[model samples]
Target chain A: MTLCRYWRLDRHPEGNTRFERFLSLHEEACAPLAPGEVRIAVEWLSMDAGTRMWMSPRTDGYQPPLPLGSRMVGLVLGRVIESLDPAYPPGVRVRGFGQWADVATVVPALAGLEVVDETVADPRQHFGALGMNAWTALVGVREVAAVRPGEWLAVSAAAGATGSLACQIGRNLGARVVGIAGGAEKCRFLLDELGVDMAIDYRAEDVSARLSQVPGGVHAFFDNVGGPILDAVLGNMAHYGRVAICGMIAGYDSDVAMPGPAKFDQVLMRRLRIEGFFIPDFLERGAEFLPQLRTWLDEGRLAVRFDETQGLENVPAAYERMLTGRNIGKVIVRL
Target chain B: MTLCRYWRLDRHPEGNTRFERFLSLHEEACAPLAPGEVRIAVEWLSMDAGTRMWMSPRTDGYQPPLPLGSRMVGLVLGRVIESLDPAYPPGVRVRGFGQWADVATVVPALAGLEVVDETVADPRQHFGALGMNAWTALVGVREVAAVRPGEWLAVSAAAGATGSLACQIGRNLGARVVGIAGGAEKCRFLLDELGVDMAIDYRAEDVSARLSQVPGGVHAFFDNVGGPILDAVLGNMAHYGRVAICGMIAGYDSDVAMPGPAKFDQVLMRRLRIEGFFIPDFLERGAEFLPQLRTWLDEGRLAVRFDETQGLENVPAAYERMLTGRNIGKVIVRL
Candidate 1:
C-alpha cells in the first residue's frame, strides 16, 4: 500500500488569516480507486485564491463550503498512476480539481479531469499558458468584459496568475491595459514584463486619482481583488464600461460577505455593467478557447512566472503567499 | 407679458429630506425664446425620484448635479403655445424636460422634446404609457433585465411609476413577478390591481426570507430603491440572473453616496449580471418601443394610477410624497 500525504480541513477559519490552524497535514494509506475514479501522482499543486471560500462556513458561497475533516481541495497537475475511468488512463499527464496532496484520487467528471498536451517546452505549462488561468483570461478579456480594440482595459491583481495572463490577453486584443496590484515590484512586473500601458501600485498609490487620469476613463475592467479597489475602478469607469469579476480575494477570507463598492452609484451614473463570472462555469467551452491560447503561447505572447514551493508541506505557505499578494505570479507547490 | 413662477435651486441640499428649504419659487417676466426654443403651457409636472440626485451637490451623479440657481428641471406635459422651432408647432400637445412653472421654456434638442400623441384616451397617459417612465420600464424590464417568459422577476419600489409599470410588463412578457413595496396598501395594490405573481410589504416582512421561498431563485431583478432592498434581492438571485437598475431612490437624497449592497459578493456567487441604464440614453429608441407600449395600453394590459397634487405650490409636497414612498403609482403636480 502506498502512503498519501494531504491537507485536511480541521475547522472553519474565522478572521484575517489562519491557514495553518484550520488545516492540518495528514498521511494515510492510499485507498483503492472507486468506480469512475482516477488516482494521480501529483507533481504540482496550483494555489488558487477562489478555493479560500470553501474554507468558510458560509453556505451562500459559489458552492457549499468544504465540510470539517474533509481533504482541502485545489487544482492539481500530475501524471495518472492508476484509473478506473478509461478516459484518464495511467501515464497521461492531466490537470484539474483535486486535493492538495502528494497522491490525489479524483472522480474524472467531478474533477474536470483531462489529459494535457505533452508537446509543450515545459510540463508546467499545463498550469500556465494552456491552463484554466489562461482560459479565464481569454474568455474574460474577450467575451465577459467584451473589451474592444483601442479601449482601455484595467485588471486588478495584475501580478497574479489570472491577472497577468489577462493583461497580456488585453494587449493581444489590441486594448490598452492598466494593471493594478500591491507593491512596486508587481507594478514593475506589470509594466516591464507584461508591457501593460499603465501600472498602479494600489498599496501606495491613490488608485482613484490615477484611474481618473485615464484619457476617457477605463472602458473595461477584469477584476480579481474586490473591495476598496473595486470602488476605485467603479468611480473612474467611462460611460457604458463593463466589469468582469474574476475573483474577490479581498473579501474571500471573511465570514461576512463584503459590502459592495462605495461608488456603486457610478454604475447608474456611468451606465456601467458589472458581471461576475466563475471559470468553472465556462469549462465546457475550454476546447473552443484552447486554439487562441495555444497560438498566443506559441507566439510567446502569454508567459507565466511560476513561484514554486518545494513539497506538499509548503502548500499552505505558498497559498498564503499568493493570497496575501506576496507572490508576483502563479504560486505552485512542487509535490 | 407672461409671469413665470418657477422653482429655483437656490442652494445644494443636505440631510435626508429638504424639498422646500433648498428650492424657492421665484416670479419673473417671461423672456424671448432662444433660437430652437419652444415654450409650453405646463399642465403637469411629473415627480420623479431620479431628479432627487440633482438636488445634491455631488458631481458624480448621472449628470453633474443641476447647476445651483438654475430652474429645477423635470418632465412636463402641456400644449406648446410658442415656438421658434417649426417642428413643434403652436397648439401641439408635447412632453419633454422643462422647468417647474406655469409657462415652461425649453430648447427642443436638450430637453428631448417630442410631440406626443393627442389621440390617447387621456393626456396623462403621455406621462404614463407613452411617457419616459413607460419607456424606462420597457427598456429596463425587457432589455436590461432581459426577463424571459416563465422566469421569476422581482421588482423593488413596486408601487412607484417605473416599478409599477415594470411589474405589468414582466407579466405581459409571461414572466412571474414578485413586487416588493413599502406598505401593505402598496402590496395590496400590487397584488389586487397589478396582478403581480407575488407581493411583499418590505416594511412588514423579511424580504430575504420571502424571496428565498421562490422555487428557483429570482432570475431577474428590476431595482429602483437600492440599499438593503438590493442586498435582499442579491442574496436570492438565481445563477446567471440579470439586474436592471432603473433607480436607486433609497440613496438619491443622501449627500454622501449610499453604501452598496451588503451582500455584494452574491454577484460573483450567483454569477449575476448587474447593469444600469438611463432612459435618456434610450430616448431615441422610443419610437421602436412605442408600438409595443401603445399596443399594451390599447389591449388594457397596461394601466396607470396617477396620484395627483393640485397646483404648482403643492409640487414640493407631491415630490416629497413620491420620494418618501408615501404615494402610489405615478405622482404628478398640476400647474
Candidate 2:
C-alpha cells in the first residue's frame, strides 16, 4: 500500500497568524479506488482564499466547514495514478478539488475533476494561465464587471492569482487598469509585470486618494480583498459603476461575519452595482473559457508569477502566506 | 405679478425632527418666465424620501444639494399658469420638479416637465398610479430587482409611496410579497389594503426573523429604508438574491455619510446582487411604462393610498410626517 501523507485539520483556526496550531501533518495508507473514484499523485496544491472560509467553523459559508481530523482539501494539479472511472483513465494530467497529499483520492464528479490539455508546453499552465483563476478573471472582467474598451477597471489584491490575471485581461480588452495591492513590491509587480496603467500601494498610499485621481472615477472594480479596500473603491466609483466581488480574503480567517463596506451608501448615491460571483459555478462553461485563456497564454500576454513553497508539509505555511498577502502572486505548494 | 408663497432652505437640517430650524416660509413676486421656462399654478406637491437627501449639504449626493436660501424643490402636479416654452402651454396640466409653492417656475427641460394626461378619472393619479412612484416601482421590481414569478419579494417601508406600489407590483407579477412597515396600523394597511402576503411591524417585530420564515429565503428585496433593516435583509437573503435600492430614508436627514450594512459579507457568501437606481434616470421612458401602469390602475390592481395633508403652509409638517413614517402610502400636500 502506498503511504499518503496529508495535512489534517486539528481545529478551526482563530486567525491567520497561528494556522500551524490548528492543522497538523499526518499520514495514512492509500486505499484502493472505489467505483468511479480516481487517484492522483498531487504534484502541486493551489492555495485559494475561498477555501479558507470553509476551514472556519462558520456554517453559513459558501460550503460546509471541514470536519476536525479530516484531510485538508484544496485544488491539486497532478496526473492520475490510478482510476476506476473510464472517463478519467490513468496517466492523464488532471486538476480538481483534492487533498493536500502526495497521494489523493477523489470522486471525479464531486471534486470538479477535468482532463487538461497535455499538448501545452508548460503543464503548470493548468494552475496558471489556463486554470480556475484565469477563468474567474475573464468572467469577472468581461462579463460580471463588464469592463468595456477605454473604461477604467480597478482590481483589488491585484498582485495575487485572480487579480493579476484580471489586470492583464482588462489591459488586453483595451481598458485602463488600476491594480491595488499591499506593499511596494506587489505594486511594482502589478505595474511592471502585469503592465497595469496605475498601481496603488494600498499599504503605503491612500487608496481612495489615489483612486480619486482617475478621471470620471473607477467604472469597473474586480475585488478580492473586501474589508477597508472595498470601502476605498466604493467611495471613488463612477456613477453606474459595477463591482464584481471575487473573494473576501480580509475576513477569511474568522468565523464571524465580515462587516460590509463602510461606504455602502455609495451604492444608492452613485447608482453603483455590486455582484458576488464564484468560478466553480461556471465549471460547465470551462470549454468556452479555455480557448480565450489559451490564446492569451500562447501570445505570452497572461503572465503568472507563482510563489511556490516546496513539499507537502509546507501547505499550511503557503496557505498562511496567501491569506496574509505576503506572497506576490499565486501561492502554491509543490508536493 | 403672481405672488408665490414658498419654503426656503436657510441652512442644512441637522435631523428630521426639526425642519423649522433650517427652513422658513417666504413670499416673492413670481418672476417672468425666461427663455425655455414655464410657470405652474401649483395644485399639489409630492413628498418623496429622495428629496430629503437634497435638503442636506452633501456635495456628492445623487445631485448637487439644493443651495441654501433656494426654493425647496419637489414633484408638482398643476396647470401651467404661464410659459415661454410652447412645450408647456398655459392651461396644460403638467408634472415636473417645481418648488414647494402656490406658484412655481421652472426651465421645462431641466425640471423633467411633461404635460400630463387630463383624461384620467382622478387627476391625482398623476402623482399616484401613473406617477413617478409607480414608474419607480415598475422599474425597480421588474428590472433592477428582477423578481421572477413565484419568488418571494420583500419590500421595506411597505406602507409608503414607492414601497406600497412595489408590493402590489410584485404580487401582480405572481411573486409572494412581504411588506415591512413601522407599526401595526401600517402592517394592517399593508395586509388589508395592499394585500401583501405578510406584513411585519419593523418597530415591534424582528425584521430578520420574519424574513427567515421565507422557505428559500428572500429572493428579491426592494429596500427603501437602509441601515439595520438592510443589514437584517442582507443576512437572510437567498443565494443569488437581488437587492434593488430605491431609497435610503434612514440616512436622509444627516449630511454625514451613513454606515454600510453590517451584514455586507453576505453579498459574497450568498452570491447576491445589490443595485441602486433613481427614478429621474428613467423619466424619458415614462411613456413606454404608462400603458402597464394604466392597465393595473384601471383593473384596480395597483391601488395608491394617499396620506394627504392640505395647504402649502403645512409643507414642513407634511415633509416631517412622510419622513417620520407617520403616514401610510404616498404622502402629498394638496394645495
Candidate 3:
C-alpha cells in the first residue's frame, strides 16, 4: 500500500498564510478504483494564485470552495498507476484536473485528462506555455475579450505564468505590450525575459503616469490583479476598449472586501468592456488551439519560463513563493 | 432687424445655483448671414438634463462652454425666414444645434432644418418619437448593447423621452420590457402609455426586490439615470448581460463627485458588458430606424408623449422641473 497525502485549508485568512495553521497535509492509503476509473500517480502540480481562491466560497458562478477536510483541486501531470479503462493503461502519462495528493481516483471524462502524445517535443510544455497556461491566456485574449492585433495590450501581474504568456502573445500579434507587477525584479523579467515593451513595478511607479507613455491609451487590458490596479486600468482605457479579467489574484486570499479608490464613471464615459474567463472552457476549443500552439513552439515563436519546485513535500512552500511573487514563471511542483 | 434673445450663465457655480440668479437672457439684433447661410426663426428648443452638462469644462468631448455671454448649444426647430443659400429657401422648417435665441444663422450643412415632411402623421412626432430620441434608443439597444428579441429589457427614467421610446422599441422587438421611475404617475405611463411589461417606482417598492420578480436577470439594460439605480442593475445582471449607458441624468446636477457604489467585481464575475453611446455616431443608421419608427407610429404600435412648456422665458423653470423629474416625456420649450 502506498501512502497518499492531501493538502487542505483549515481557515481562510485575510492575507497569504502558507506557514500558518490553514494548510495541512493528511495521509491516506491508496484504494482500488471503481470500474471504468483510473488512479493517477501525480508527478507535477501547477501552483497559481487562483489556488488561494479555493480557500473561500466562490463569489459568483465559479466552482464552490474546497471543503475543510478535502484535498485542494488543481491541475496536475501524472502517470496512470492502475486503470479499469482500456484507453488509459498503466505507465501512460496524462494531464488532468486533480488533487494536490499523490494519488487520485477519477473517471476519464470527469477528470479531463488527456493521454500525452509522444510526438510533442516537450511533454512538460503541457503544464507551461504550450499547455493550460497558454490556453488560458489565449482564451482571455481571443474568446473572452476578443482582442484584435495592432491594439495596445496591458497585462497586470506581468512576470507570472499567465501574464508572461499574455505579453508574448500580444507581441506575437503585433500589439504594444505593457506589464504591471509588484517588484522591480519581476518588472525587469517582464521587459527583458518575456519581451514586454513596457514594464511597470506598481510598488515603485505610479500606474496612471506611465499610462501616458502608451500614447493612445490601452485598447485591451489583461487583468490578473483586481484591486487598485484594475481601477487604474479603467482610467487609462481607450474608447471602446476591452478588458480581459482573467483572475482577481490580489483579492483572493483576503477574507474581507478588498478596497481601493475606484472610478466607475470612466467605465461609462470611455465606453469600456471587461470580461472574465477560465481555462477549462478552452477545452471545447482545444483542438483549434493545440495545433497552433505546437506550431508556435516548434518554430521557436513561443517562449516559456518555469519556477519548478522539486518533491510533493515542497508544494506548500511553492504556493507561498507564488503568492509572494518570488517565482519568475509558471510555479510547478515536481514529484 | 429681428430681436433675438439669448440666455447665458454669467459665472460657473461650484454647487447648484438657483436659476433666477445664475441665468440671464439678453436681446440682440438678428445678424445677417454670409454666403451659404440661412436665417432660422427658432420655433422650439429642447431643455432636457443634457443642457446642465454644458455649464462645466468640456470633460465629455462636447464643445467648450458657450463663450461667457453666447447662446447655449442644443437642438432647436426653426423656420427659414431669410436665406443667403438656395438649399434652405424661405418658409422651409429645419432642426439645428442652435439655442435660446429667437433667430439664428447657420451654414447649409449645419442646418439640419428641412421642411417638416407631411407624408405621414403628427408633426410633433418628428421632434420626439420618430426623431433623434427614438433613433438614439434603437442605437443603444441594437448597436451598443445588441439586445436580442425575447430578452429582458429594462430602462431607467422610463417615462422620459429617450426611456419611453426605448421601451416601445425594445417591446416591438419582442423583448420583455421593464421600467423604473420615481413615482406612480410615471410608472402608470410606462405600462399603460408606453406598453412596458412591468414598471418599478423606486420611491414605493424596493428596486432589488422588484428585480427578483423579473423571471431571469435582465439581458439588456438601457440606463439614463446613473446612481444607486445603476448599482441595483449591476447586482442583478444576467450572465453576459449588456448594459447600454445612454446618460447619467440622475447624477449630472450634483457638484460633489458622485461615484456610484463600487461594483467592478460584478462586471468581472458576471462577465457583464457595459457600454456608453451617443446618437451622433448612429446618425448613419438613424435613417434605418426612422422607417420602422414611422411604421410603428402609423400602425398605432408606438406611443408618443411630450411635456410642452410654452415661451422662451420659461426655459430656466422648465429645466428646473426636468431636473426634479417632474416632466414625463420630452421637455420642449415652445416659442
Candidate 4:
C-alpha cells in the first residue's frame, strides 16, 4: 500500500478563503484498485474560482457546498499507476474531477474520467487552452452569443484563463476582439500574442469611455470579472447586443454583497440578452468543440498560458493570487 | 376643408407627464388626399408606457424621443374616408402609427398603414389582444423564454395590459402560472378571471418568500414591471431559468434613478438567461402569430380586456392612470 496525501475541508471559508485554517492536510494508505477501477498519481490540479465557491458556507448557489471533513473537490490531470479496467491501462493519462490529493482512485463508470489522447503533446494545455476554458469560451461566443462576423466583441479579464481563450475564439469567429486586462503587460500580450484588435488597460482607463471610442460599440461581451465592468459594458453595448456571464471573480472573496449593474436600464434600451452559463451544462458540446480546438493548437493559432506553482502544498497561495488578479492566466498546481 | 384636432408635444415631460402643459390641443384644416395618399378618421388610440418613454427628454433610448413640436406618436385604428391609393380606398379600415387626431392624412407608402379586414367585428381588439400587447407577450413567452409545458412561469404586473395576456399565453403553452400584481383586486382578477395558478399581492406579501414555497421554483419569468419585483423573482428562479423583459413600467415615471435587482448574483448562481426585447423587433413573425391569435379569439380561447375611455380628450387622464397601475388590461381612447 502507498500513502496518499490529501487536503480535506475542515471548515467553511469566511470572505477570502483562509485556506490554511479551513483545509487540513492528511495522509492515508491508498486502497488497492478494485474491479473496473483505476489508481491515478495526480500530476496537475486546476485551481479555479469555482473551488472557492464550493468552500463557502452559502447553501444557495450554482453548486452545492463541499461537505466538511471530506476531501476538497477539483479537476486533475493524472497518470494511471494501477488499473483493473481494460479501457484505462496502467501508464495511460486521464483527466477528470477528483480530490485535491496526491493519489486518486477512480472508478471508470462512476468517476467522470476520460483518457487523454496519446497524440496530445502537453496535458497542461488540456487544462488551459484546449479544455474546459476553451470549451466554455466556444459555448459562450458561438452557441449562446452567436457572434456574427465583423461584430465587436469585448472580453473582461482578457488575460485570465477563460477570458484569454474567449478573446482568441472571438477573433477566430471573425469578430473584432477588444481585450480588457489589468496591467499594461497583459494588455500588450493580448494585442501581440492573442492577436486581439484592441486591448484596453481597464486599471488605467475608463472602460466605458474606451468602448465609446470604438466605431460601432461592443456587439457582444464575454465577461469573467463582473460588477462595475459589467455596468460599463452594458452602457456601451450596441443595439441588440449579447452578454455571456461566465464568472464573477471580483466579488468572490468579498463579504459584502456586490452591487448589481447601475446601467441595467441599458439592457432595456439596447435590447440586450444577458446569459449566465456553467461549463458542465455544455459538456456534451465538447465533442463538437475539441476538433476545432486541437486544429487551432496544432496550427499555432491558439496559445496556452499557465501560472504554475511547484507543489500541491502551494495551491492555497496560487489560489489567493488568482483571486486577487495577480496571476496572468490559468492557475495550476503541478505535483 | 375639414378641421382636424390633435395633441402636439410642446415640451419634454419631467417626472409624471403634465399633459396639460406639455401637450397642447391644436386644430388645423385637414390636407386633401393627394395621389398615393389616404385620409383616415381616427377611431381608437392606444395609450402605452412607451408613450411616456417617448415623452421623456432622455436622448439615449430604444426609439428617439418624439420630435419636439410634432404630434405625439401613437398607434391608431382609423377608417379611410377619402383615398387616392388603390389599396386603401374610401370605406376601408386601417391600423398604423399615427398622431392622436380626429382625422389623419396618410401617404400609404410613407405611413406604415395596413388595411384592416372588414370581417373583424371589433377593431379595438386589434389595438390590444391582437396588436402590440399580445404580440409582445407572445414573443417574450414563446420565443425569448421558450417556456416549456409544466414549467412554472411567473409574470410581473399580472393584471396590466401585456401582463394579463402573458399570463394567458403562459397557460396556453401549458405552463403553471404565478402572477404578481399590485392590489387584492388585481390578484383576485388574475386567479378568477385569468386562470393563474397562484397570485402574489406584491403590495402586501413578500414576493420572494411566496416564491420560495413554490415547488421546484419558477422555471421562467415574463417581466413587464421591473424594480424590486425583478429582484424578488431573480432570488427564487430555478437553475437554468429564463427571464424575458418586455417592459419596466415601474421606473418609467421615477424622477430619481431606479435601483437594479439586488439578487443579481442569483443570475450567475442559477445560470439564468435574462433578455430584453421589443415587439417591433419580431414583426416578421407576425404572419405566424396573427393566424393563431385570430383562431384563439374566434374560439373564445383568448379574451380581450380593454379599459376604454369615452373620448380622445380623456386620453391624458387614461394614460396617467395606466402609468400608475390604476387601469387594468389595455388602456384605449375611443375617438
Candidate 5:
C-alpha cells in the first residue's frame, strides 16, 4: 500500500487558517478507477489566491463546496500510474485540475492529461509560467476584455503568478502595462524585474492619485485583487473600457463585511464591460492556445517565473505564502 | 409676436419639484439661425421619465443639467418654417431633439433629422415606436445582452414605453418574454394588449419567488425600474446572463436617502453581465434599425401607443403625471 500525505483543514480559523498536516491518505481513499479513468502520481502542485476564495463559503459562481478534510483544489503535474482510458496511458505526464496531494487518481474525462514532450527544458515549467495561471491570464484578458494594443492595461496583485503573466501578455500584445501591488518590493519587482511600464505600490500610494498619472484612461483593467483598487481603476477607465474579473485576492483572506463599496456610476459613464471567468471553461481552446503560447515562450516573447517550495510537506506553507503575498510569480510545491 | 406657453423650472426644487408653466414668445425667444440652420414650428413634444433624471443634480452620468431658465430639452415633431441649409427646406416635416416650446430653431448639422413618413400610419408613432425609448429598448436588450432566441427575457416596468417595446423585441427574437409591472392593470395590459408571454404584477407577487417559477433562470434582464425589482432579477440570473440597464425610473426622482440600494453580490456569483446604453450612441445604426422597425410597425407586428396631454401649457402637469406612472407609452404634448 502506498502512502500519500495531505494538508487538511482541522478547523477553519475565524480570521485565517494555516494549512496543517492531518491524517495521511491510503490507497483505499481513492475509489477504484472505472473505465475512462487514470491514476496519477502527482509531481507538482500549484497554489493561487483564487483557491483561498474557495476555502470559504463562496458567494461567487464557483464549484461544489471545498470539503473540510481534503486536499485543496489546484493544478497538478503528474505521471500516470495506471490507466483505464486510451487518451492517458501509464508513465505519461499530464497536468490538470487536481488535489494538492502526492497522488491523485482522476478520470480521463475530467483530466487535461497530455503527453509531455521529453524535449521540454524542465517539468516544473509546466506548473509555472506555462500552466493554469498563465493560461488564465492570457485568456481572461484577451478573450474576455478583447484588449487592443497601445491601450492601457492595469493589473492588481501584480507580483502574483497570474498578474506577472498578465503584465507580459499585455506588453507583448502592445498594451502599456501598469501593475498595482501591495508593497514596494512587489511593486519594484513588477516594474524593474518583470519590465512592466509602471507599478503602483498600493500600500504606499493613493491608487486614485496614481491612476491620474496615466494620461489616457485605462482601456482595460485586469482585476486580480478586487476591492478599493478595482474602484480606483473604474474611475479612470476610458469610454468603452473592459474589466476582466480574474480573481479577488485582496478580500479573499479577510471576511470583509462587503466586497467593494464604490458606486458603479463609472460603469455607465465609461460604458464599460465586465466579465468574470474560471479557466476550466476554456479547456477546449487550450489546444488552440498552447501552440501559440509555446511559440511565444520559445521565442522569448513570453516569460514565466515561480516561487517554489520543495516537497509535499511544504505544500501547506506554500499555500499560506501564496495568500500572504510572500511569493512572487507562480507558487508551486515541488516533489 | 405670437404667444407660445412653455414649462420652465420656476425654481430648482430642493428635493422633488412640481413642474410649473409660464407664457413665452413663439418666435422672438428663438435664437436667430446661423449659416446651415433651420427653424421649426413645433407640433408635438415627447415626454419621458428620463426628464426627471435630467433635472436632478448631475451626481452620476444620468444627464447634463437643464439650464436654470431655459426650455426643457425634448424631442419635437414639427414642420421646418425656415431653412438656411440646403439639406432642409421650408414645409418639410421632421423630428429632432428640440425644446418643449411651440417654435424652435436647429442647426443644419441637426438636419437629416428623423422625419415622419406621411405614407405611414400615425405622426406620434415616430416619437414612441421608432424614437429614442424604442431604440434604447432594442439596443439595450439585443446588442448589450446578445440575447439568444430560446432564452428567457425578463423586463421590469413592463407597461413603460421602453419596457413594452423590449417585450415585443424579445418576442420578435423568439424568446419567452416575462414582464414585471407594478399593478394588475399594467400586468393585464402587458399580457392582454401587448400579448407578452408572461406578466407578473410585482406588487401582488413575490418577485424573487415568482422568478423561480420561470423554468430556467433568466437569460437576459431589461431593468427599467431599478430597485427591489432589479435585486430579484439579479438573484436569479443564470450563468453568463446579461442585464440591460435601460432606466432607473423608480429612483430618478428619489431623495438621496431613498436611492435604490442594489445587491451586487449576485453580479459576481452568477458571472452575469450588466450594460447601460444611451440612444445617441446607436444613431449610426439607425439606418439599419429604422427600416426594419418601420416594417414591423406597418405589418402590425409592432404597436406604438401614447398618453397625449393637450396643450404645451400642460407640460409641467404632464411631467408630474408622467413621473407618477399615471401616463403610459410616450407622453406627448400637442400644440
Candidate 6:
C-alpha cells in the first residue's frame, strides 16, 4: 500500500474562499493499480483562479462543482511509477487531470492522460506558458478575437499567466498590444518585459481615460478580470470590435451575485462580438499550437514567468494568492 | 413650389418620447430639383425600434443624434415626380433615407437613393420584409449566429419584425425554432403562421421554465429585447451557444438606466458567443440576399406580416405602438 496525501472539499465556499476552512488535508492508502491503470507520483500541480470557481456550487456551464468530501480536481504533472497501460509505461512523464496528491492511481483512459516530451528544457513550462494558458491565449487571439495587424488589442490581467502570453501573441500577430495590470511594477514588467505598446496601471489610473488617448480605440479586448474593467473597455471599443472572455477572476470570490456589465449597451452600438471559450474545446489543435509555441520560446519571442510555492501543503495559499493577484504569471505548487 | 408637411426634431426626448412636445410639424415650400437632384412624392415609410435609439443623446455607434430643428432620419419609398438626373427619371420608384414628408427634393448622391424595382406585388414590401428587417434577420442567423440543423434556436421578441423573420430563417436553415413574444395572440401567430416549433408567451409563461423543456438547451438566441428576457435565455443556454444582438426595445423608452443582463456570467461558463451587429454593415451583400429573399417569398417558404398604420400624420403613434410591443409585425406608415 502507498500513502497518498491530498486535499478534499470540506464545504462549499460562500463568498471568497477561506481555503483552510473549505479544504481539508487527508491521507489515504492507495491499492495496487488495476487493469489499464497507471500509478503516478505527482511533481507539479497547477493552481489557477478557476480552481476557486470549482469549489462553489455549480451555477454556470463550467465543470460541475466538486462533491463535498471528494478529492479536489486539478491538473497534475507526474512520473509513472507503475503502469498496466502500454502507452504510459513506467518512467514516462505524463500530464492529466487528477486529485491534488503526491500519489495518484488513475485509469489512463478515464484520466485522459497525455505523455509529456522529456526533451523540453523545463517540463514545468508545459503547465505554464506552453500548456492550457498558451492554448487559451492563442484560441482567444487567433480564433475568437482574430487579432489582425494594426489593430489595437487590450488585455486585462496583463501580468498574469494567460494575459502575459496573450500580450506576446497579440504583438507577434502585429497588433498594437496594450495591457491593463494592477500596479506600477506590473505595468513596468508589461512594457519592459512583455514589450506591450502601452500598459495601463488600472489601480492608479482611470482605464477609460487612458484608453481614450489611444489613437484609434481598441479593436479587440482580452478579458480575464471581468467587472468594471470589462465595462471600461466596452465604452472604448472601436466599431465592429471583438472581445474574447477567458476568465472573470474579479467576481469569483463575491458571495453576492455580481452585476452585469453596465456598458453592455455599447455592445449593440459599437457592433462588438464577445465570445467565451474553454481550452479543452480546442485541444484538437494542440499539435498545430505546440510546435509554434516551441519555436517562439526558442527564439526568445515568447516569455513565461511563474509565481511558485513549494510543497502540497501550500496549494490552498497559492490558490488564494492567485485569486487576489498577489502572484504574477502562472501560480504553481511544486509537489 | 410644392408645400411639403414634415416632422422635425423640436427638442430631445426626455424619457418615453412625447412626440407632441419633441417633434414639430412644419409646412415647407419645397425647392425645385437642382442639378442631379430628384423630387420624390414620399409614399411609404418604415418605422423601427432603431428610430427611437437615433433620437436619444448619442450613446452608441449608431447614427448621430438628430440635431434639434432637423428633419428626422428614416427609410422611405417614393415615386420620382421630377428629376434632372437621367439615372432617375420621373415615375421611377426610389428608396433611400429621407425626411418624414409629403415630398422631398434630394440629390441622388446625397440621399443615397437607389431606384427600386416595381415588379414586386407590393412596393411596400421593400420597406418591410424585403428591406432592412429581412436583411438584419438573415445576417444574424446565417452570418453571425450560424444556426445549423438539429439546433434549438430561442428568439426574444420572436413575434416582432426581425424576430419573426429570423424564426422562419432558422426553420428554413433546418433548426428547431422557439419564439418568445409578448402576448397569446402573437404566440399563436408564431406557431400557426410562422411555423415555429415552439412559442412562449413571455407575458404569461415562465420563459426559463418553458425553455428548460427543450431537449437540448438553446443553441442560439436572437435577442431583440435585451433585459430580463435576455437574462432568462442566458440561464438556459447550451454549451457554445451563440447570441445575435439585433435590437433592445426594452430600454429604448426607459427614463432610468437599464441594468445589464443579470445572468450574463453564463456567457463565460457556457463558452457562448454574443455578437451585436447593424444591418447597414451587411448591406453590401444585399445583391446576394435580395434574389434569395425574392425566391423564398415566391415559394411561400417565407412570409411577411405588417402592422401598418395609414398616413404619415400618425407616424408618431405608429412608432409609439411599436415601442410598446402593440404592433405584431413590421410597423409601417402609408403616406
Q: How good is the docking of model 5, by CAPRI class?
A: acceptable
lDDT of 6 by residue, A63-100 (tens): 87777888898888999988899999989999877888
The CAPRI class of candidate 4 is medium
lDDT of 1 by residue, A1-335 (tens): 87999999999876536589888999999988788899999999998889999999999998998999999999999999999999988999999899999999999889998899888888888888898898888888899999999999999999999999999999999999999998998999999999999999988999999998899999999999899999999999999999999899999878888888999988888899999999998888889888888899899999899999999888878988988889988888997
Per-residue alpha-carbon lDDT of candidate 2 for residues A201-291, written as tens digits (9 for 90 to 100): 9889999999999999999999998999999999999999999999998888777988878788899989999999988999999999999
Q: Is candidate 1 or candidate 6 better by TM-score?
A: 1
Candidate 4 chain A least-lDDT 10 residues: A250-259
Q: What is the lDDT of candidate 3?
A: 0.77
Q: Could you tell me which 10 consecutive residues in candidate 3 chain A have the lowest summed lDDT?
A: A255-264
DockQ per model, Cα: 0.87, 0.86, 0.42, 0.67, 0.36, 0.71
Q: What DockQ results for candidate 4? A: 0.67
Extract clashing residue pairs from model 3: B94-B113, B94-B114, B95-B113
Ten contiguous residues minimizing lDDT sum, candidate 3 chain B: B57-66
* C-alpha local distance difference test of each model: 0.91, 0.91, 0.77, 0.84, 0.74, 0.85
* TM-scores of the candidates, chain A only: 0.98, 0.98, 0.94, 0.94, 0.92, 0.96
Q: Which stretches of model 2 miss by more than 4 angstroms?
A: none
On DockQ, the stronger of 1 and 3 is 1
Interface RMSD of 4: 1.3
Question: Chain B alone: TM-score in each candidate?
Answer: 0.98, 0.99, 0.93, 0.94, 0.91, 0.95
Q: Can you write out model 4's per-residue Cα lDDT over B179-251, one digit (the tens) per residue?
A: 9999999999999889999999999999999999889989999998888999899988989999998888887
Q: Residue by residue across A300-325, what tens digits does model 4's lDDT show?
A: 87787899998888877777777777
Q: Model 1 off-target regions past 4 Å?
A: A14-18, B15-18
Give one digit per residue, the lDDT tens place, for model 3 in B272-317.
Answer: 7777776765655656778888888888877877789888888878
For model 6 chain A, where is the 10-residue window of minimal lDDT?
A: A250-259
lDDT-wise, the better of 3 and 6 is 6
| Colliding pairs, model 4 | none
lDDT of 1 by residue, B1-335 (tens): 87899999988876546579988999999999989899999999999988888878888888888889999999999999999999999999889999888899999989999998877978998888778999999999999999999999999999899889999999999999999998999999999999998999999999999999998899999999889999999989999999999888888777888898898899899899999999999889999999999999999999899999999888888988988889899999987
